[model samples]
Target: MKRIFILGAIFTLALNWSCGNKKTTEPPVVKPPVVSKPPEAFAGFLTVLTNDASRKIEIYDPTIENWNAAEAKKWSWAPTTALGFVTADINTFGGGTDFKLRKVPVWNNAEYAALTDNGFAAIIEYPSGKRKWSKRLSGNLHSAELLPNGNIAIAASDGGWVRLYASSQGPDQEYYAEYPLISAHAVLWDPKTNVLWVTGQHAITKAHIITALAVGGTDAVPELTEIDSWRTTIPSAWGHEVSAYYGNDNLLWVTSNGGEYVYNKTTKTFSPAPTAGLTFVKGIANQPSGQIVLTRPDYNKNPRPAMNCGLNDWSTSTVDFYSANGQLDGSRVVNGACFYKVKLLNSSYQ
Candidate 1:
């Protein structure tokens, strides 16, 4: 009876060992990688260049569902309203930063550089609408860009020149140098490459700022040197607007008389943007969240007769918004006010 019990115990131990050694067929589980959520649409304010008798730079909060000039005009800057300021038609809106004062420039405290079609350019403190500097530029002024060295660059379309001013010298300082660019309409300073990108009649040119060395080692003045240029693809091309595609630094959002395009820096090629085929896009910019904001004439709606909508009454009272996927999501309209160019108020050139 003892021998039989011992054999039974050995059999039980073998069975337990076999069960423990068995291999399972199930695969190992994997947790998916964490992805951050995209920012909400129209999260911040949009700075718009409104062309009316006032010729004002208006700020509209996109977060407001129903925004209008009367109710939503919380902040605005009219050159006509400022003391001893030239009442020029507000043309371009570009973001600027005073790195010494603010780490992150917001809509209220940031410095903005703007130009008028009638040869007026100025650097104004936003919200306060105080003019830090003002100059009456020559030719048909289209755009002004603030440089890293506290200088300002102007693109005069009719004169075909890109002018550089030594702004640190003082307000109303004359330009020290000018670069030849036919029908120059837009100027943008690239912080990454330390180059200025200018859009001309038929090409996009890249220029380097050449600062002269003074006798005492002080920087005398800066000049622009053309590095290279890419001829645009549009037939009878007339470059009107150019802005950095914040969604991709390698790409630029360019608008011409024919249509809109995304210029790929890597490939040096031009491709139609999602908003391509849209007409009269005076301004186009990408938000940090990858959405696009733009201004163009809505011909379907007639301009208000009381206001001067400018040249053929082309200016519209609407600012259009597009999703990252190139879909038209929404629009904000300000009655009685014609908006020409729309810019994201935040200082995010990326």
Candidate 2:
């Protein structure tokens, strides 16, 4: 009887301990609160004035949201358009004379020489304030890319041709070779194949063509004659121009007054895309990370609420960005007192 009572007590105590352990181990069935992730890092744009002495090329550091303009003053000149950067002339006003000097040299027979006019190229650097190795070309250079050999390949307007150049050569040197191009505005070099991939013009009047140049010999001609050419029947009478980009899935993303068009390179044609809130699309830039930046006039016209209107209203001069798939990302209004061109720095900020 005593053994039976002891065994019963032990079993009851073990059951009680097991029940207590289960209760403590199992957490309450409460749900966790939801959290929404912040949006992606937005691209940035700035209004640049040709006359504004303070205007400069800025480098933005995303980590600290800080902008460093140390390289601005060192630049010989900068392009005036929003189509990225272009080579420009560097001129020194009132040559080599201090304003406080006794023999002050006044403006005389000094002429503005073509510091570096190898066609439409951008000044990448001007280390010693001299035009050395200032890229030279045969055709009208619309865009340039610096190569690993300290040379540059410029996309010329003459045909889909790209001219190569070395920094040690002069403007009169014959380092340029003709590569097939058709109305291309921007040319990017592919180091992998030593070839060039060009971005053609946007407008119908301008040829809608993109070409790829194969790399090999210095005297070698363009390997691929033509990659693709697209034509649209959309009426382009109102000074409407077309801009295109090679987007994801081998799709060509084009923009015009008629709206956005996506052209499948495989099918060799174009189809309209959704551009509901977009307007006055002048320039389009497709980033490698599937984001796009476009320049357009501000749509907030006069008599609209939330916008202060005045004679000095410069809101029309602005640029906005959208996602790679065509979503309204964000926008920034240029802060110049006067209306002018706006350009995006090659950096991202909040």
Top TM-score model: 1
lDDT (10s digit) by residue, model 2, range 1-350? 00011123222322211100011122112111122223344543232222122323222222222122332212223333232232333231101000000110121322111111224333232222222234323343334544443344565444445555543243334355555544443444443334455544433345344445554444222123333343233221111122224335455444332234554545656564433333223345455555555543232222222322122221233334456555655543334311212222322100
Cα lDDT of model 1 overall?
0.53
Residue-level lDDT of model 1, residues 1-350, one tens digit each, is 00011123222321211110122222112121122343233765455555543456566677665775355556666554443365442332221111111111333435554444445667665446666567765676667766545566777766777877776566667746777777676777666656677776433433211111111111237766766444333321455667778767888777654456777766766777775545345678777677778775543222323333443233566776777766776766666666656666655554
Best by lDDT: 1
Q: Alpha-carbon error at 129 in model 2, in Å? A: 10
Overlapping backbone residue pairs in candidate 1 total: 0
Local distance difference test, each candidate: 0.53, 0.33
Task: Give stretches of model 1 more than 4 Å off.
Answer: 1-41, 69-71, 80-114, 202-219, 229-236, 299-311
